[model samples]
Target: MSEKLGAERLMPNEWRDDLEALDLEIVRFAIICQVKLLEPGVIQRVLDNDARDCIHGNQTAFASLRGLLFLHFQMQKDLAEAYGPSDATEIVRRVWAHLQPRVGDQLGSLPNPGALSAV
Candidate 1:
């Protein structure tokens, strides 16, 4: 008799989709970060909260996160140039508020850190 493979053992395209989804999450987070940066008070609050601790400790992960941060900064700069710095922050904040929950859901679907570490 042949043994049956479980769903976990079966390869699925969901993994790739999940990764792509993660990229989108990072983009969304970056946008929020940009909005937060626009307000010195908000940026100070975020730094005081030590939110960086949530990021992965690995160098590659850090670099990837930094890249996303830079992307958001650039996006903010572009918007400011086009729409005026006075209103760019508000626009970013609104866009981020819409994107945040979707990103959170996608991130929540990913495997936990321990599972990734085991691999």
Candidate 2:
């Protein structure tokens, strides 16, 4: 058996730390789903649901719990690693802005970390 599969290693595409650069055509096409694609709020809900399942002793909850924990911790690590925890709320607001493009930028861009305004 061969050590390698039928493939060649492609270019490494860690988006050089600038979210804005994704606006370019080539850069935009080179989409990679990272923490950017996930909405922290939704991840929170999934975590919450998984916790509840754990409480109820769902048969598969243990595996689900482990994955969720990794995801949870990873998100925390990502925040501390990329932008300090202080900026977590701002990140959420930026998500909200994308969610409601009709809203004016100034207002839509306000940071409401824990509190999502009524749509």
Best by lDDT: 1
After superposition, candidate 1 runs with Cα above 4 Å error: 1-55, 103-119
User: In order, what is each prediction's RMSD in angstroms?
Assistant: 16.8, 13.1
In model 2, the runs with Cα more than 4 Å from the true position are 1-55, 92-119
Residue 57, candidate 2: Cα error in Å is 1.8
Residue 43 error, candidate 1, Å: 7.5
lDDT of 2 by residue, 1-119 (tens): 54532211111122122222222221111111111112334334434544332234443534444454444345434543455555544553454444444333312233443443211
Instruction: For residues 1-119, write the lDDT of model 1, one tens digit per residue.
Output: 67534323322333233333444655555344433222223333333443453343344444455565444455555545655665555555455445556655433332322221111
Model 2: how far is 34 from its true place, Å?
A: 29
lDDT for predicted candidate 2 compared with the true structure: 0.34
Error of 1 at 56 (Å): 3.7
Best by TM-score: 1
Give model 1 RMSD, 1 decimal: 16.8
